[model samples]
Target: MQASPIYIPSESMDADAYQQPMPQTANTPSLENPEDSVDDSTSRESWRDNKKPRQKALYLDNDSAPEHRLSHTLQLVEELIKEKEILEANKELIRCVALTRIIYGDGHWRLAQSYANLAHGYLTLRGLPAQAAQHAESAKEILLNGLDMSKSDEEKQAILGTLVTLYYTLGAAHLIQNNGRESLHNLQKVEKILEELQTLDGGKAVVLKISEKDLALALGRASVLQNKLNSAASYFEKVIDYVIMTEGDSTPELVTIYQEMAKAEQSRSKHDRAIEHLLQAHSIAIALYNKASVEAAEAGLLLAKAYAVSGNYDDAAEMYFAESLRAYQAALGPDESETLNTLVEYSKWLVQIGRNQEAYKLMNSTCSSHLKTSGDFSETVAEVFHLMGTICLAESKMQKAYKLLKKCLEIQTAVYGSQHKKTRQTQELLNMLQKSPTTSEGNKTR
Candidate 1:
């Protein structure tokens, strides 16, 4: 469920498997006493009388001032979250929460901001998916309610930005749930709201940054849902350039963008570009020791798929299929359907590599598991059948091959229609099998 970079063992993991060291954090800024603020306020008018604007600037600056300290503090919190320093980020969030409470008393918009920051910190880190989802949902509720109570455009925009982030979190959760329609609906709302906001205020508003990143990601996701590989490629290409520009080409975020972009490219048959992006993503993942990350797994699988498609059978078999098989096995062990689908893809690669026996074994395992847990109606299972048919054909089992291939064709036509790419592919496979003679036929001819 949690995607991270794959880590190859240098020696072994037994020594460090259970020991996770906490990341370091900076100390929190101290808050001045209320009495000191009161004293300062009392002396303000006399000080203003004695000193000019430039001379009095230093004396008047207070931690409690809206522009002076709060803004800087919020920026610091944002930076910490960006760095993935969860504990320190939470510390900053709590401080902001306390400050907002002090400013707005309680149950007010300021306090809502603190909660939103805390929610963001949880969402950004790799480890806190469930908690992140909960906090994001809570922040969305508070921000929406706060919008009704506030009249200021800036305040409303800030709250709306948080709502945008919350929607993204919700969308990601729905994706995990395999609820494509719900995820698309939530993401569509975010896109619509952002479009409206851009029209009203243009870019550079507080909401704009969040909108840009989230909307681009959503478009890519929606394309995936619709199985429009080209459209997804377009969406990924749009934001990937921007991500590289802002985060540097080597940053983890940029690597993630490239990993997804590679998927789009691979789907479009851009094998060289796909392999290039995959390599970059894999490099970054390894550098970060992100071997267990989603990005790395995705990159490895995509690279393998690309190599298989490009007819580099040896590399596909040795590198791509091997790593992808390991990753898919790791992912599917906990009963993840997505991982099973990936496993099915790896099986396809195996078939391509002349590993019919291995592919058949994988399909059997996949078919058995899916039959027990869910069903055989999934696209993944359909693919497994197709691979099985190909395997049977390779082994000169014509009757079994014909049956499986025909079944696969029927399933594809039922799900995607006769004209769909996948349906057409299955049809072609079936036709080739029907026309080709087996080794047994050659023996009969002799």
Candidate 2:
């Protein structure tokens, strides 16, 4: 975890720093056209006299060449995709698809590439899994329909590259759509082809540019969707091994591997192992970022949750949770609103286990922080205060509970008028507190 900055930076300065313009692109020089060459059969001297020098120069400088225009236009989509501007990339992709279809018709390889790109765009951006599947299927079907069965192995392998990308996209889309069976089917097909290529290339299939790591990652995700946890773990283990061998711990892939592995462990109720994996992810995240980072806090939050659900109510478990909470705070900073999300999850788990004292203490801390950060009238502050008031009433602190509850009611009424659901709920809490602030029974402990 990183030390919090002693001083705060101005938000406007940060915004200005982030708005720097992109660098300009350099122009490609014109190339000579071989088709415009002088006939050697008519001797060099004869052609040199007949062929106008201007004609040769004009051919070499043909800026409107079809191949050049196609390449330049296609590059626009590629660059946008790299920048993660999916909407802009999709627009460029549509233009390329239309141009390619006009130039070489529907079944052409170039047109198929554009379709595959459109699928990629849809898959990366949420709310379009069906569209992603549509384009992926179109690319695969077009390639299979156009290519001859009798084509050479080299030619087939070349086309299969595109098919491999299409298959991966199709599998990802199916997974997103919760069609696990279909997702697994596509992933299996990709794995088979990759295995065959590995053998044929004598283990030098890096030329294919698709590593075993990539295939394993896809298969692992598919297996997870199918509820095949054991198989998914094995696949993820392979991917983890590959990432460690090639990229080491500093890369983001290593962090993701640890996170997913932790999830698998958590599913099996292997809390100790899950905690270990989450810690590993957290340590790696610390190296990747200098300060409070979303990824690091996520790892810490997962660790805290693991401790809570590990079915232990001992002092050790309590201490572990406390440390995990500190890590969350350290990685997420003092008062980022997102901190509430993790705190809420942890508090709910505490309430589930009947650890009311710990839950109350946590709620108190959260409410204090919320009050300090954005003050009394905020919705989050009111919510935390309401929780604190409920806990106080349970603990039989009548006066304390009444004060906290009334404060929460006032905040809600001010922000959301008395007719609003939240305001009404707060009013109900206040009414209940007034009617019975101190209960006959004492709070129960786990």
- Candidate that scores best on lDDT: 2
Error of 1 at 203 (Å): 12
lDDT of 2 by residue, 1-446 (tens): 01121111111011111122223223211112111222223423443344445422322222465555456556755555555554545554555565567677878876676677666555553235666678788788788775664555554555565666678778767776677899889978876665444333222122332346666776787787788888988998887886786666577767877888888878877788877887788778778864356776666666667766777634544554555555557766546555665666666677677777788788777556565444546676666667767777777787677777778888888888889998887787666755662421221211
User: Which 10-residue window of candidate 2 scores lowest in summed lDDT?
Assistant: 5-14
lDDT by candidate, in order shown: 0.59, 0.62
Per-prediction tally of clashes:
13, 0
What's the TM-score of each model vs. the native? 0.47, 0.67
Once superposed on the true structure, which residue ranges of model 2 sit more than 4 Å away at CA? 1-68, 71-92, 121-131, 144-147, 177-181, 196-211, 287-295, 313-317, 327-333, 345-362, 372-383, 402-446
Tell me model 1's lDDT, rounded to 2 decimals.
0.59
What's model 1's lDDT at 197? 46
Candidate 2 lDDT score relative to the true structure: 0.62
**Cα misplacement distance, residue 374 of candidate 2 (Å):** 6.7
Model 1 per-residue lDDT tens digits across residues 253-294 = 666667777777776788888878777877886576555555
